[model samples]
Target: MEFDPALFIDLFARTFTFWWVILPAIFLGLIVGAIPGFSAANTIIILLPMTLAMDPEVGLIFMVALYASSRMGAGIPAILVNIPGTAGAAATPLDGYPMTKQGRGQQALAISFVSSVFGGLLATIITLLAMPWLSQVAFYLHSVEMIVIMLFGISLIATIAARDTLKGLIAGFFGLMIGYIGADVVYETPRGTFGFLELYDKVPLIPALVGLFAVSEAFFVIEGESILSKRGKEAMQKAGWAATIEGVKIALSKWWHIIWTSMIGLVIGVVPGAGAAIAAFVAYQQSRAFSKTPELYGTGHVEGLIAPESANNGVTSGTLVPLLVIGIPGGATAAIMLVVLQYHGVTMGPDLFMESPELAYGPFAAMAVTYFIMIFTILPLARYMSRITVVSTIYMSPIIISFTLVGAFVPRQYMFDMYLALVFGVIGYVARKTGYHTAAILIGVILGPLLETYFLRALKMSEGDIMVIFSKDLANVLWVGLVISLCIPYAMQRWRAWKAAA
Candidate 1:
């Protein structure tokens, strides 16, 4: 666990020599990430044969670059078109799309890119230095502690519901009901599926995501000439590279926000099955909870965008920690990396660090390098990418539906998923028209099942004792933190109101 400046410096320089491999992968990752239903994990799987053909070091660097860049790419569409390329980017469009509607798409993209790169780079460095201790996070966070952590994310629903408690609660509970559609984990009986075989397994996330965000948004856009307002169109047309510069400045100004939010992702990523989605949501909730201007969150606040983008990208480094230190893959992407490493006859775990320190630490070093390269590579494209907003919705709506429908199909390749997406699309449109928050519903859909799984596991361990949640000291501490986090915004709001009255 001792930090070795010389060793890391050497690895960093060596990774730079693979810029040829890294550069192309970065571009490919952006494309893969921006497209709905595609992810670095599946894309890597599709290209496994090609990856396996390369040397282990080259392969790891390639995957690292692709993984980091893809995290950034998922934000681009989320910012411009209100389509989250992946679940991790789900919290992104809450603010990013609003910025686009106001003709600040270029600035938003710039902020997202900068926050992602720096946030990821910082986490990668921290992971390298603290890998020995950070790996222990997985072992310490048992089912009880994770339940509390899950609450941290699920609390976001209540936060979103703050403006109109009843409608938000209705939307959130509705999504939770939908999430429970599959067979109960403890028993084999289906809960809400209406006799469909596919429903017995579970409602697939990709179709649900694209349907609610992409397809639903596509439906609304057709009611206008463009996704932008008249003033927004004029501002966008007049925008130059200055907007990109403004974004970078904005992100840099919020350096403290990036640091803490990304740390949230790093800690969560160490726990197995706690993917970027949870990290992003928790970070956004915490950001809003602690902000002085909490009301500005969904209305295109820069911090709102930064919090999720930073946290999600920070997950890139944290996922590698358990993979290298404990022979456990933190996520699907890390699992694929494990296969490649095993193929190359490299054993993981602590021994790998001692026997082959280069391989053990090389990927993190490569990640740091990849993030450094990404800002320069993708930052210039924000100006051009933002222009998509000015396109006529007549053409754009069909294009979005076509691509999203295809994205819905790619994940499971079930014809049923496409139909399911349209169903959710109509549902989303109805909710939007009824003044309900789709993001609140989404938080429920994503976290409800996870909460149930952990809660059931805790209960099973405790012989169905409900108080088992309070059995762990770590769990108790997390509960206290969660309570404080949830209370702070309301307390702050009341304080401001009292001051105004005085």
Candidate 2:
């Protein structure tokens, strides 16, 4: 019942003692993060069982380190190749690629790394401080309110659809429909499984994530001899330690920039459903609006690069707040972490801290140590990392596909998963070729069941009255917030257009 300084000290001491575990994960993350399409979530899913096998502390530390660096690694391709490794890094290229074109590719990479470390570190501390206050939020948000929160995340699908709401919504709903494949929770009747026993359970997440993100991306990666642009090749040749040092100076000098943008990431990350992609874009937009030199933003600016990188990594910490404090995963990566925790029999939420302090606090502590390791590890390798773009895709593609396909078979050890992965890969490839958003579909598959489960629980408690969603006071408040958020943007856009016409 009392705060024991020794326990807190022991947790960090234990984490620090696991240097062997933390260091490898950071580098592993860097490798995957640099390659477009190899998201950390899929990688973790592929290797989920291995993590499950390790001691809980070691397993969690490994995942935390990889997840954090994965966000950092994505910035590499965005700056060098004009292609973001993960959608979270999508905002990085707005200014990063221009810097690369200006022969400042290494500098951009350095700034990205510094911003990420600073944001991740600061957000981790903030999360540690805020955990107690934030945990109380879970008490008020029961199933009814949680359903609204799920909708809030689903709403982000439209924004990521990239000017194609119809396609995004279709993808989201389709994933949701697929989520109902297993037998209904209330009754024993299978909802959508044509006949297979596999359908009697549920769709395996690992195969679905790998097939859609990793395998589909490999198909695209092979189309090129190299992943780099001609100019990117030139930039890589000249990068070295000096350039990385300069980046550290640039990022550290703008301490306020990193702090504020990272806070933006923290706020959005806490909200259910909003991931780094939204956080990065929001931070970028805010930075531009408040800039004294807004005109310089899209033209290879350090501040521009800093904002998004900081925010996305800040999101890394923010996502965990909900998962640890409320048992709700805020995004896909957080969901993967949830699976690992559940597999290991670690219950989340406030009580987790009291019951399993080591498990509850270990992830945050590991995050801090990881950032410490990342700064030194990634900085020296800026030169080496930049050169990766030059590696021919001929070599890279097969390695990526073969490894990921293997990963698809890891979770359940079922051949059905391999087939399922290929099917999702084809679907992902089609979605990529068309305008449909892969994230929307993935989110649908991941969160659809969660949403349905909560909705049904709320309805059942209220004797099947759909209006139960608005019965609770917190639910009413959430509904109001959701409606305003959905309507205000369209209304504001129309108002601006009308004024211009007048």
Candidate 3:
């Protein structure tokens, strides 16, 4: 497909004309993304309803830009405080936290920002160039193929489940069960609601997600009172552009890791159901595998810092691929965008590309633009953002609780959501304390509906043949991939244990 200069010009015009809407969304996204527990997906859900009256193109561009920017924004806290604002930033803490302890906080923050911007911009280019081809591929995916892809995504849970595989599986199974609480897609029969009117719609995505990620994170924050301590003013003062440039130089030295991880991110992001967390983890593992001293990976290695940060940011554009091309959400953030698109009466799918290339390409172009903007905007503000690390838990607890409650209740205005958030907060704390991953459970929640719906539909479609899923070549390949993904982590853990014993 040839580049359409007219379309590019039109998108550029729209973005320039709607700078007011775009800038505010970008700013809000950055702020929310920087805040621990306020994830990009949740922020999109919170703000999507408000964007209903705006032009579809404007709203799409604004939200997509915000989504891309938030991935970078979350890195600030992850580097400074060791508390990842989002699961995607989890790998940042591996290296970034150590850098903070070593008084390289400014350097760490700078590296994260610069690498993130580079990864994002490069991924945007990949997205723009690949969308036409990807759209063509997406058109050929049948239900069986989609089911296989989702299974491949769900298998990632085993790898991320970490040491407590059983506990992680339990958490994931519980999440899947929770996802089934609403009406059945095929028969419209209520499953787990026990006749509660609210249950009829199934658990709302915003409330459940708020409960799982945000509320759970809040509880964890309160439990760990270290968040209340103040950093020395000297450390705060060290945040500046000079430090960032040094970090960028360090990151540039490890350019190969950045390129490969970003490529991994693009591929994963293109697959529906795989999100930023998986991308970060895969990049971290791959970086470790390729390191000259793998032992240094979790010990503040610069490559460790660069790989996952770049990869996570790279996913920002990748997630948009399926969303714009096939109408299927590649991740939770994209799911929220799906709602926004539906609200605007613009159906997502091949038709979206065929009909409204402006709406499709405008957001893609804006994402590239936002990356450039963030480098300029966030570099100068690193010191201010890093200061958030010093805010004491005593002072932060109430504010966090307030936002958690408000964010939870804002979606449905229901008190039940508040309770749900509190309950999930406790759950998250327990999971974290026990080494079971909240990310795995959240993935379950995100993919559960799709898994159940497709699995059941495939069964029904096959007239109880039960072998239809495996009968497909794509399904077989995905199943094999799932087995490998699950086994690798277990194999690695066993090898580590054995080596330690030796």
Candidate with the greatest lDDT versus the true structure: 1
Better of 2 and 3 by TM-score: 3
Best-to-worst TM-score order: 1, 3, 2
Model 2: per-residue Cα lDDT over 1-502, one tens digit each: 2356788688888889999988988988987776654678877887887998998778889999999999999888678755566668767877887787666777888889899999999998788777776545445667888788677655655443334656766887887788767887777788778787876777776677666666776687677666555766676677667888888899999999999999999877887665787688668867875789866876888888999999999999888888988889988888988988888888887788889888887888899999988898888777666665566778867776777677667556788888887898898889878977666776677666778789888889999999898888877887887677557556857998999999
| 1-502: candidate 1 lDDT, tens digit per residue | 5688998889899989999999999999999999988989989999999999999989999998888888999999999999988888988988899899999999999999999999999999999988989999899888898888777656565565336655766787777778878987888788788899998877888888888888899998888999888888888989999999999999999999999999999998888789898888888878986899888998999999999999999998999998988889988899999999899999999998888778899999889999999999889999999989988998999999999999999978899999999998988888778878777777678767777788989999999999999999999998998787667657867999999999
Report the lDDT tens digits of candidate 3 across residue range 285-373: 67776677866765667887888899998888888888877787888888888888898788876676668778777777888777776
Shift of residue 198 alpha carbon in model 3, Å: 3.1
Off by over 4 Å in 2: 1-21, 28-112, 221-225, 233-363, 393-396, 488-502
Model 1 ranges with Cα > 4 A deviation: 184-189, 480-502
What are the clash counts of all predictions, listed in order?
0, 0, 5
User: What lDDT would candidate 3 get against the real structure?
Assistant: 0.72
Model 3, position 289, has a per-residue lDDT of 60
Residue pairs with colliding backbones in model 3 are: 182-202, 216-425, 227-393, 228-392, 228-393
Q: What is the lDDT of residue 4 in candidate 1?
A: 81
